[model samples]
Target: MVDELGARFATAGHEIALVGGPVRDILLGRGSKDLDFATSARPEVVERLLAGWANHVWDIGKAFGTIGCRKGEWVLEITTYRSESYDPTSRKPEVSYGDSLEGDLSRRDFAMNAMAVLLPSHQFVDPYGGMEDVANRVIRTPGSPEDSFSDDPLRMMRAARFAAQLDFTPDPAVVAAMEAMADRITIVSAERVRDELIKLVISPQPRKGLDLLVATGLADHVLPELPALQLELDEHHRHKDVYEHSLTVLEQAIDLEPRLGVELPDFVTRFAALIHDIGKPKTRKFEDGGKVTFHHHDVVGAKLAKKRMKALRFSNEQIDQVGKLVELHLRFHGYGTGEWTDSAVRRYVRDAGDLLSRLHVLTRADSTTRNKRKAEALRSAYDDLEERIARLQEQEELDSIRPDLDGNQIME
Candidate 1:
């Protein structure tokens, strides 16, 4: 089918190449059914060419010089050679079609994504040594890093995304550029930043990406709460380093996803884990003996998480779920000695509602204490709590537990 489509463009006297990330993926042996092709043909011409051939075609990206179509099971986005640049004060880019494939490739965010394969003949094109960078598992820009990031500050976030997705390291120069231009990310839309963040969080190595974001000061602007975790200081190293601890909790939560029956890329769970302790810095109290206490941090953190999620343009449902998780993350600590009554167990299930499983995962992951005995005791207590919940659930359907009377009945 690819060959057929390639032949169609070749016969029409247009130059087309499978380009950008798709080409990079092909080289990485992770061939994708979602193909991106750069063509000398304009959007309209590309639409006309795909009319009879594709099973369906859509103009979702037409304004951006891209024409989308699906042929059989394969989805393809055919785009004209185009360059997009952003005005320094503008949140959006002004797009202009380019005349050459190399020119279009030059505007891509990363060197690994700057390669292409000329269609019909299947010749490879790597004008900026992208193949070498990909082979070395290094992230770099096709041109000057400053110019590339200045053209689109979102690429700074994309660097973190790629780092997470591919587990690749950015070149020192690229890292420096990101550090220098970190504040420029504010010019990009919150929605775009949120999307990049979603990608990074769901990637297999989210910790690595998040570390880069913090190290480069990108987190300071994009997620101030994250870097704020660094302020959770302990002079003697007695306390768990809250910033690193939160990241460790995120890793542990990701590992628990499959066992806990969470869907992969569960944003709510991961975000909850990462932001669960954000309130500690705000609630810290120093005692006479230098002990730090964070009373009611769960409640404070939940409110802060909601505010941050709203700023990042998260959906209301996502905000609510993550906020609830953050608020409830500390509740399990109160279930000491497994002495709760059946009513208390029901209340626990009721408070958790549909998020009980995720709450369980978060509560467990939150135990980053260094003492093995304490860790084992916490795990054992949680195991006992789970058993009690299961037994109660079997006997009385704890998931559907409710008040014996409706609001109207109580009023009467």
Candidate 2:
């Protein structure tokens, strides 16, 4: 696809380069389906260039010098060299054409992403040591970190996001710049912030990105609920660090996502795991027995999750799913001895709704105890609960809820 575009543009005396993320990913031996280009040809010219080959073309991004088009089995976006400037009070940037590729590259968020490949010529463009940075596995801005961040503070979060996605560390200078410029993220808008955070959360190494967010003080601005989990001790001084536990649960939930089915996104399980204990910090109370209790944390956490997710521009569906998982997270604790009756199992299934299987994953992953014996016991109990539910389903299908197995049979 790129070869075809490059050949046509080259014949017209315009230099077209496959640019940005696609180029960077290719250098790392990762294939990309979505391709972008920086061409000397203007948007109108690019539109004409694509019209011959494109099955469909759209000019939605034409004002920003981008022309999106699709050819057989390929989606491509070609843009003229861009010199875009952001408005400080508003996150929207005013994008204009730049005469040179260097200007466009310099405006990009990170050096790794700033690299490009001159199509057809197969030439590599690394104006800011992007190749070296990729080799070192460190993220750095193409220009001064401060200047780069001041232009678009969202780059600060992107820096952290890429650090997680690529398992690379941000430069100390970039981290410091993020710390100094954290306030600018507020101007970028909630929806944009939510989008970046979603990318970070969905990355393979989300903990790395989350850690950077906390260390750089970026989480304080974007998601204060996260860092607020730290140092929240119970009355008896008996509690795992909620912050670390939450990260552990995030990892555990991700590991358990296969149970939810391979096709499902792990976002809800991950988000639910990350924020499941959020209410602990809010509901801490000292009891007369010299103990602390978060009596209604699950309930409180559901509300908090709803409020925060809404504030961050998450969809109502997403909020409801996460909040439901949070609210019902502790219900399994009441099912002692795996003695739940058939009616109880049916109620459990009814309460779980479409999230029944997911609730199982969340329930099991929520157990972060180091005691192998207790862990085994909890696993055994959950296995029985699942078996009971399955039995109920089969029986209901076989004889309208009056077939072969009972709670006692399941426990056995």
- Provide the overall lDDT of each model, using Cα atoms, as 2-decimal numbers: 0.90, 0.87
Q: What is the C-alpha lDDT profile of model 1 across 1-412, one tens digit per residue? A: 8788889998999999988888889778886667899999999999999998999999968889989999888898899998776777875779899889989898888888989898888998999898998899999998889888887889999999999998889999999999999999998999999999999998899998999999999999999999899864568655667898899999999988876675677888999999999999899888877788898999999999999999999999999999999999998888876688888888889999999999998998986577899999998988988899999888776536766888899899
**Count of clashes, each model:** 0, 0
Q: Model 2 clash tally?
A: 0
Find the candidate with the highest lDDT and give its number: 1
Candidate 2 lDDT, 90-116, residue by residue in tens? 768898888888888988999999998
Question: All candidates' TM-scores?
Answer: 0.94, 0.94
lDDT of 1: 0.90
lDDT for 61 in candidate 2 is 78
Q: Find the 10 residues in a row with the least total lDDT in model 2.
A: 231-240
| Alpha carbon deviation, residue 351, candidate 1 (Å) | 0.9
